[model samples]
Target chain A: MLEVRDLHAYYGKSHILQGVDLDVGEGEIVSLLGRNGVGRSTTLKAIIGEVPPEGSISFKGEEIAGRKSHVIARKGLGYVPENRDIFPTLTLRQNLILGQKSARAQGRWSIEDAFELFPNLRERADISAGVLSGGEQQMLTICRTMMGDPDLVMIDEPTEGLAPQIVERVGRLIEEIAARGVAILLVEQKLTIALHISARIYVMGHGRITFEGTPEDLRGNEQIRKEWLEV
Target chain B: MEVFVFSLFNGVLYGMLLFLLASGLTLIFSMMGVLNFAHASFFMLGAYFAYQISQPLGFWPALIAAPILVGVLGAAVERYALRPVHRFGHVAELLFTFGLAFVIEEVVQMIWGKVPVPYDVPPSLNVTAFAWQGLDYSVYRLFMLLISVGIFVALFFGLTRTRIGLIIRASLTHPHMVASLGHDVPKVFMWTFGVGCALAGVAGVIGGNVLGTEPGMAIQLGPIVFVVIVVGGLGSLGGALIASLLIGVLNNMAISYDFSLYPIFSLLGVEREAEGILADLVSLTTGAIAPLVPYLLLVLMLILRPRGLFGTRDV
Candidate 1:
């Protein structure tokens, strides 16, 4: 479980995260939906300590605000950046190994499971990550983070530039992860995937949560979708 | 033919020494993106430490002790000095390292009195190792070559096969990504800097006697090693090795051959323009511009292939 309350973050005095408050219960799939630059990604980054956070970010029962990104990561929080920051020079196997908390941590996932989940990665295990296609890279980033066996994973736009087919695969993967009892705090743009998979949806506007309810509650609310989400 | 053969052999030896210095530099530059101007200063410290410590404990122990001392000092400098400047960006880090080099030189002068110390080869290695074309090569130079080769082999294995090596190699390309994977990246960086400095220190310990351990030692060797790394490529260790040997052999050959371009011009039946700059350019000898060879190669390499021989990215 993760809880964020009144989290304010800044990039050189330009206030990005004004006061974001959200939560993801254990084994729950929660989606935060917003248009670009409404601080959706920033919220994830602030939670991961990629940017400094004000107020409190509690993981399970312990506070983890303002810790280093690596510290936050070892404390069982996984972040998949929007850029798909795979080590372009390393092989896929090397990248996955680095995702493990220690050199020999057998945690919960294996490289074989990753290959089974997405066979393309196993085929290109020896090649450098730079040559991976956009979709393969997305799969690698998600699987690599999962290798760390985080209790909760925060994914920032896992399907932004992926093909529709690959996007569908990603949606299925998110469900599979949730089914395995791993909570997901997904920052997504596709309203369809969010509506399908998210137990609850929070619509954000201008660095603050504007709506928090069940997916059915959000689907019925046309006014919130028009004002805050749809272009 | 013998002159050519001897020069070629000497060049190989010199090149191996350059490789010892350049390999560490290229790795440091690759991983930290810091062009450490003080690297050769650590080399200088190694020489000085060897000279001082050898006086009490002898050359054998000094060979082992000096590098460790330099490594510890390098680790401290990285943690205390370089880490602070890192936040100010690469240029600030560069200036800090540059200034640090100056401080080190002054410190060396203050302690050693600006004089070349008497750092000599041990009595055991003083004899000739073997005869080359009836000319005996000192065992000391041969030992230096052996030490360099050993370091090269050890380094190659350590980087390719070890887990820490994976972290180091990964950190070079994607530092933040490595950190997010749960590594203390600053600690990795500090160890890298320390190890890189230790390599340079090893070079100095063995090279001090032959090269002379003076305050100006870094100045004499620094530019040439830079030429080695740049010509090889910014981040490619393999390229560094090739470039080092190429420069070393070419420098040796150039110094041996007193060649002027004026004869070629006359052979081609080209009329020399009297009192023109063309006459000045043609008469230049290979020996005269031998020191400029590496720079010429650098410029040519940059113009033709900016990424270098094995480089994946631009410097």
Candidate 2:
């Protein structure tokens, strides 16, 4: 379980995450939806301790807001950045190896499971990650975090630039992740995938949460979608 | 032929020494993105430490102990001095290291005095390894060559084969991502700095006797190391090797030849009595300009190929 309360973050003097609050129950899929530059990414960044957080954030009943990124990570939190920051010079397998909290520990997932989930990664396991296409890189980044075997993983825009069929595959993978009982806090711009996958959805506007409800409740609210989500 | 053979061996020996220093410098730069001005100071420290340790325990123990001691000092410096300055941005970091070089030099002088210490090759290794023509190569020089080559092989494998090595390569490009993956990146940095310094220390232990263990030794060898990395291409281990050997062999050949530009000038139909700068240039012998070879190569590389020979990214 994760609980965020009154979170505030800043870049220079301009406040990005202004007094935000959200939650994700154990094994639940929660999507944070917003337009560009509305602090969706910053919210995830603050929760993970990459950006300096001003409020309390509790992961599985322990406060983790101001801790260092690696410490928070060892506490079983994983983050996949929006840019898919794969170590371009490293091999695909090396990228996965780095994701593991410890090399010896057995986790819920294995490199084999990652390969099974997507066979393409196995085909190019020895090659450097730089040569991977955008879709393959997205899969690698997600699977890289999965190798850490975190109780909860925060993914920012996993399908932002992906092709349509790859987007469908990513959707299936998200479902597979939740099926394994790992909580996901997904930051997304596309409402269709969010509506299809998320158990609960929180729509954000101007650095604050404007709406929070189940997928059915969001689908019926045309006014909320028009004002906050629709371009 | 004898001159050529002797110069070739001497050049390779010197090149290996340069590689020992350049490899560490390249690793630290690639990992931390800090152009450590005090790297040569670490080399200087290694020699000084080896000299002091050898005074009591002899060269063999000094060779082992000196690098470990310098490594601990390097780690401590990273933790206390460099880490604090890191938050203030790269210029601050650069100035800090730049100042660190002067401080290290002053400290060495205060303790060791301004003069070169009597750090001699061990008596056991003082005998000639072999003789070619009239030139005899000492066992100590061969020993230096062996140690340098051994370190290179070890370093190469250590980086490419080990898990920690894998982590280091990742951190070089994605420090934040590596941290979020649960690696203690700062600790990685501290150790990286330590290991890099330890390498310089190894060079110091072997090189002190050969190069002379003086306070000014760091300053004297500092610029050439920069030339090496820049010409090799910044942050490339393979590039560093090629650049070091290129500069080393070129310098040795220049020094051995003792030829002047006068013949070329005559062939170009220049007046024999060419005035001022032209006369000065014509009269300059290769041996006299040997010291300037690396710098000249560095300038040429920057002008023609700024990214370096094996660099993946631009310098």
lDDT of each: 0.88, 0.92
- DockQ per candidate, 2 decimals: 0.66, 0.86
lDDT of 2 by residue, B9-93 (tens): 8899899999988998998898888999999999999999999999989999999999999999999999999999998998999
lDDT per residue as tens, model 2, A1-231: 899999999998999988999999999999999899999999998988889999899998999999999999999999999999999988999899988988797799999999999998999999999999999999999999999999999999999988999999999998999999999999999889999999999999988999999999999999999999999
lDDT of 1 by residue, A26-117 (tens): 99999999999999989988888878899999998899999988898999888888999988877899888878878778877888988899
TM of each candidate vs. truth: 0.94, 0.98
| Model 2: lDDT of residue B168 | 88
**Which residue runs of candidate 1 sit more than 4 Å off their true CA positions?**
B263-284
- Show the lowest summed lDDT stretch of 10 residues, model 1 chain A: A99-108
**Candidate 2: residue B157 Cα off by (Å):** 1.3
